[model samples]
Structure formats: structure tokens, C-alpha cells
Target: MPSTVTSHHRDIETDRHARTRITVTTTADATAVTVTGDLDLATSPRLRDRLDDELKLRPRALIIDLDAVGFCSSGGLSVLLEAVTNAHARGIPCAIIATQRAIIRPVKLLQLDRVLPLHSDRAEAETWLALVARLR
Candidate 1:
């Protein structure tokens, strides 16, 4: 049986500026990280840390929900790329979900979607994951 993992939520403040909310939910199927707020220079570190922690769990898949992310700078984009690389190295499938144009525009403009494996919704993300499954 897979051990249960609790959901983690936190507010990160940097330079008394941007705020980012990161929520990590782990289960037998997959570990999901939902990001809300600006993912810029100051806030990117917090997201990176959260992503690293979730990756450590080595879940069946890493799903990043970026729908609520209003802004994503290079720092934020880099974190997503790094997460994908790390997940691949660990043999864990990864998917990024974004429904809003705010986040998608930058990702597409940078051509990050090619390497990031982005989806408009969780359903679509899962549909794209070839071998991942919910064994429970």
C-alpha cells in the first residue's frame, strides 16, 4: 500500500512584494502541485523549493496546475523546465496544466511547451500521460 501524504499550503513573501501560493497534494496515484500567484524572480524560488520537495516523493506523476498563475517570468519558466528534467531523471512522468492566456502566452512564446508537456486541463494532461495510472 502507498503511504498517505498530506496536502501542504504556504504563502511565500519576498522583498515584501509578490506573493505565491503553493499547494502540494500527494496520493497513491500521483503528487500534484498547484501554484497560485505571480511566478517571477522573487517568487520563483519558493515554487522551486516546493517542486523539489514534491519530486522527492517520486510520485507516479507530477502534475503542476498553473491556471491561477497570473504571471510567469524566466525564473518561473526555468523552474518548470528544471522540474521536468528532474522528473524525467527520476523516471517520473510530469505534466503542466494551464487554462489561462496569461500563463500560456509566455510558455508558448518561449516554446517551453515543447519540453514542458503542457495541458489545458487535468483531464487532458492525464490523457496525454501514456503509461501513468492510478493503481489504487
Candidate 2:
């Protein structure tokens, strides 16, 4: 089951399990994606699509808000890595919001924290994006 919602030029997609939802919102300087729910094998594809869609827009910065994520598997991590790689290849700055230890611990264990800067909240992530845009 796939469901999509479009609002104010933003595209939102929810997976069949209804356990995962990805909301993509674009601003003048950045694209912000909010993920809510478990990000595992069953829902990683949805996230990949959403991220790819946002990247296609070629925004100056990409901010992923993962504060609501309860779990993330290797498959989900792969999707994230792909997104970061794609963004970097395009010279787009990417930021992640992972205030929860459940989300932060796995990323840190994999040393992904070094490559993907993690923020404590959406505001901080947005600020980072803004600063990156200003510098570039």
C-alpha cells in the first residue's frame, strides 16, 4: 500500500505498514524531510523515493528531521547513505536531526555520525543549512 499527499508543493508519502511516513517540504534555500516511525526493510524504499525526489530538486541544503524515528535498520541506513552521497555529489549540504539515542546510537556505532552531522533539533538543523547556504 502506497499513499501520497501533496500540499503547498510538498510531497508526502506513507508506506503500507503505515508505520513509516516521509514528508518532503522545500523552502527557498533548503529542502526539509521529516520522518516519523520505524525505518527498516519494509519502509526504507519509501524513504529512498522521497529522498531521491527531494534531491532531484537540487536544493542548496537537505535537512532530514528524524526525531520521531523509533528504529532504524541497516537497510534504512543504506538509504540514508545513498541520500548523503547523492547530495554531496551535487554539492548540497545534508544535515540530520537525531535527538533520540535510539536513532543516534546506531549511527554513531557505524561512524556515520562523522559524515552526517547530527543536530539536536529541527531548528539547529535548519540553522546549519542556512549557514551552509550563506557560505556557499
Candidate 3:
């Protein structure tokens, strides 16, 4: 089991002058980081920080649970991209659990689907892991 690093919600004021709320949680295995709430420019740095720290732990996989993400902007996309790039460089896999279009649309639009695997939910992510395990 991964340890919980921090869990809380905060308001991030964006350059567009929009106020967004972001909730973040990290588990002990330090492999999964669940983000709930809005993800925009102002709150994206927080995500960057969390991901940077998690990568240092060198987990086999990184799971970003975004099923509860309410909104996302380019900054949020950048953070996701950063994580994916880091994962690729380190030969680690990153999984995204997202059901909402708001979260999925951007990833698809950017064709990041070609890079990082996205799942509809946690169960699906686990299933993918199992498949990968069998394949290996």
C-alpha cells in the first residue's frame, strides 16, 4: 500500500482571472495520484510538483485518477504531458482514469492517447495492469 502524501482542496486563480478549485491526493505506494476538482493554469503547478516528487520514487506505474476532475485547461494539459514524458524517459507506465469528456477530449485532441493509456475507471486501469503483467 502506498502512503498518503497529502490530500486537500485549494483555490487557484488563473491568468484568465478564473477561480478554480483543485483537490489532490497521493497514496503510500506513491504510485497513484488522484486529482479531483478543476485543473487549470493556476493549479497546474501543484500537479507538476506532485508528479515530480512521485517520479523520484520510481514506481513501476503512475496512476492519475481524473474521474472527478471538473475542468482542465492548457496548463493542466502541460502537467499531464510532463508526467507522460518523464514516464517514457524512465521506462515507467502512466495510467489515467477518466470518464468525463472534459478530461478525455483534450488528451484525444492532442493525440496523447498515443502516448499514455487512458482508462474509463480504476477497475479498467487495474485490468490493463493485469493484462500487461500476463504479457510480460
Candidate 4:
């Protein structure tokens, strides 16, 4: 019999100068993390912390939504790379949602897009997660 995991949701907002918000929703198969506002030197730590907290939950997959992000700096990219590395090390799949050019362009330039599974929207990412869950 397949075990069922309960769903959980958390919304964490930071009061830092960059004003980033993180919302994490976890289900049996995956964890969806939505990030909004600027992602720069002043705010990357907040995101890093949130990712760490979610990673501790040990979800089968992690989907990071960056559609609402207004800006992303090198610091933010570093945080993202770290998250991907951490997830992979734990045998968890990780995907990214980044439609806007602001987020996509930089990622492509840095070749991080190749390292991360990039999706255009939440639904696409969720579909991938579903497939991964089914395979597992």
C-alpha cells in the first residue's frame, strides 16, 4: 500500500530592504515554493533559510516558482544553485518556474538553466512532479 502524506502550507515574509516573500506548500509528492519580490544581496539569505527549512521536510520533489520575482542578483543565483545541489544530494528532484525575462535571462547567461529544471509555469512544474512521483 502507498502511504499518504498530508498537505502543509507556510507563508514566510521578510522585512528586509529587498522585501522578499516565500510561500511553501507541501503535498505527498512534492513541495511548491513561491518566491516574490526582489532577490538580491540583501534578501538572498531569507530565501536560503526558507529553502533549508523546506528541504528538511524531505519532499520527493521541490518546485521553485520565480514568476513573481522582480529582480535577481548573483547572490540569489548562488542560493538557487545551492538549493539544487542540496536537493540532488538528498535524491530529491528540483524544478524551477521562471517565465519572465528578468529571471530567465540571467539564469541562461550563467548556464544555471542547464543545471536546474526550468519550467514556464506552475502547472508545467506540477506535471513534472506528478510524473516523478508516479515513477517512484
Give the TM-scores of the predictions, in the order they appear. Answer: 0.82, 0.86, 0.74, 0.87
As for candidate 4, its clashing pairs are none
Candidate number with the higher lDDT (1 or 3): 1
Superposed model 2: Cα runs more than 4 Å off:
1-11, 16-18
Query: Which should have the higher TM-score, number 3 or number 4?
Result: 4
Model 3 quality (TM-score): 0.74
State model 1's lDDT: 0.79
Per-residue lDDT of candidate 1, residues 35-77 (tens digit)? 8888888878888888888788778888899998888888888
Q: How do the residues 74-94 of candidate 4 rate in per-residue lDDT, one tens digit apiece?
A: 998999999999998887888
The number of the candidate with the highest TM-score is 4
Which portions of model 1 show Cα errors greater than 4 Å?
1-16, 130-136
Worst 10 residues of 3 by lDDT: 7-16
Answer with 1 or 2, whichever has the higher lDDT.
2
The TM-score, computed over Cα atoms with residue i paired to residue i, of candidate 1 is: 0.82
Question: For model 2, how does the per-residue alpha-carbon lDDT over 1-136 read when each residue is reduced to its tens digit?
Answer: 0114332345486775656778877666667898999888888888888899889888768888889999888898888889999998999999988887767898889898878778998778877777876788
Cα RMSD, each candidate: 3.9, 5.7, 4.7, 2.9
lDDT (CA) per prediction: 0.79, 0.81, 0.71, 0.84
